[model samples]
Target: MLFKESFSMAFTALLANKMRSLLTMLGIIIGVGAVIAMVSVGMGVKSDVVNSISSLGSNMLIVSPGSTNRGGVRGAAGSRTNLKYDDAKAIKEKIKNIDFVSPSVSRSYQIVYGNQNWNSSVMGVTPEYMSIRSLEVSTGSFVSESDNNKRNRVAVIGSTVATNLFGTTNPVGQNIRVNNQPFKVIGVLESKGQSSMGQDQDDVVIVPLTTAMERLMAMDYVSSVNIQVSDANKMDQVQEDIEVLLRQRHKIIGGKEDDFNVRNMTSLMETMSQTTTMLTILLGSIAGISLVVGGIGIMNIMMVSVTERTREIGIRKALGATFQNIMMQFLIESVVIGVIGGIIGIGMGCGLSMLVGKFGNFTTVITPLPVLVSFSFSVGIGLFFGIYPARKAAKLDPIEALRYE
Candidate 1:
């Protein structure tokens, strides 16, 4: 059969030039390896982003007083003193969907335990902040309402903060000095990893907002406030309610922009997800160009084979071989190279992805859709690039091809 003849010819050609075949396949191997490695890295980054975002809390909202990159986020450094304790209380009491509210006050200073002092971030927050932010207390309790009222000199240390300040011993009831002010350790928080902005949440010490404002910082202005809605589905309604309440409380005139901005956690997470999806698509498309280049390499080599096998082509043509047979032969040779290379590339891709995941210490999802699509694209590349060369081989004149010197 024609198919048997073509396979026989292909086997003969491949065996006759073992080194050349391998050298040609090298391009495909490298291309596939790069694609897999880059994609795996992207997947790992996406996972990190999701975890970081979710750590902030799902039913939470952040109200910041600023614009630009600092807008709608915490840690606003130079914003006006627009937010207050009254606003937090109002949101908690008035907003039906809001379950909890916590005003944020933060500063960085040297904290001392015994003779050792280390500089770290310290935050002043209400009691409900522990629940809103899902902060767990490893020892003792978070700041109580009495502590807030009496301006109690008490602090809750993060796990890492505790380790740095008072290693191996219970920190509760022990006194640590912040900016030379003595505050008793009331609790140690469980470890929460980095935030979306790459800030380490574990390197912190928390105290009551009232105490921080009146005693430590000597200021009444809060940096931000975190609000948690009762239900995830009612997030937009809650956000709108908070906006209206804040604007009314601030007494802003009609049509003027709000001095404070409230941001929904669900919207923020969706935005991040959409941006990452676009990034993944762009990166994959760029990597696909390498597969096309590898396919071209196969086509170029097949053309040279056709040139060298002119006598064989002429003999087949004279012995009743049709143009379709010649075309099919060359087409099969090129496609075989692509198919074999693709299979090897897939194996190399998976192996290399695992290596990247291990060394990078991040998640790499080898999803089925990407692999299937990538393989199909590679095969298409082979077929499209092989057309011109295959046609040239098929159109040869029997007399002239047989008489070639």
Candidate 2:
């Protein structure tokens, strides 16, 4: 028989038992829908993480104090005071591919302006911190080199601090008390909202590095140093160079762990991306299990179909229908069920993903690749599951099948 004739006959048989065909396709529908929705959610979360990391800055590196080991136990990372202002200054001067550098110290303090007060992180940094951290002033200006050199008590406040302390008032040119030490607010930084870790990025106050170290915190060592690389390709080399320079400056010898750690933000971003990609794959794989179950359901239904149509198979064989014709007919019926179910599932998944994004407060992304994959996989499942039953129907003996009750 012609392939068209086989397909037409298969379609007609399914229509004869419309309810049963619909029921048989239900598993595939649910399976495909689940896979699509799960994958979209994973993609959305990955996108959010990438955006959060990108917002920090481009081609950036951070140098922080490493742990100190006294007697056999080591302190937590960044607990030591090994990094100093001169170390940062030397890095800016000696390191190649360095765009900007900022040595910083931080402490939490209660900031009071008029009758309002808020607790926020106060960081001591040079003017170069602005460019290195991609911070912009919405009013006034950032700290200057002269400000740090003179140990001026000036500050640049973040949006959250501004709101909590000043409330709808522009914080520039105002005076605020940091730990009860009055400092003039020279600028209000643009809002950065939140980081990937959900910390409020805008709840900060910036001051001159000298003022913070000498006046506010009364400390000698910097907590960390920020570096901005001029080129993306130079990040790794620069990180290594910074490690070498810092080791020399700190007088650390070979075969010993350094007192400072150099962190490449690009590397951090890559690590985060890899983690998110793995999670996406894991979720997709879990959701894919349903598809296999659906395929099994298809096989069971096809087997039942063959058993019910045994007499019909015998009659067709008696009427000159070849084995290939019988096999193709049954296979076409199963494939048609899969194709129709897959199309419906795709629509259902898209709608579900949209709903989740709208009401679930989550970012959902639906790319074309997942949809195509799910559809193709569904079709393959149908063909695979239908093969066994189709073969059995084709191999039936006409004489015995016709004589059986």
Return the top candidate by lDDT. 2
Models, CA RMSD each: 3.4, 2.7
Cand. 1 TM to true fold: 0.87
Q: Report the lDDT of model 2 for residue 135.
A: 84
Give the Cα lDDT of each candidate: 0.82, 0.89
TM-score, every prediction? 0.87, 0.89
lDDT of 2 by residue, 165-265 (tens): 88888888899999999999999999988775677989999999999999999889999998999999988899999988988998989788887778888
Give the distance in Å from residue 60's predicted Cα in candidate 1 to where it truly belongs.
Answer: 2.3
The Cα error of candidate 1 at residue 315, in Å, is 3.0
lDDT of 1 at 245: 92
Lowest lDDT 10-residue stretch of candidate 2 = 67-76
Candidate 1: stretches off by over 4 Å:
2-11, 67-79, 318-324, 347-365
Pairs clashing within candidate 1: none
Expressed as tens digits, the lDDT of each residue in 249-333 for candidate 1 is 9998788778887888788888988887777777777777788788879888888888899988998899988899988888777
Candidate 1 residue 349 Cα shift, in angstroms, is 3.9
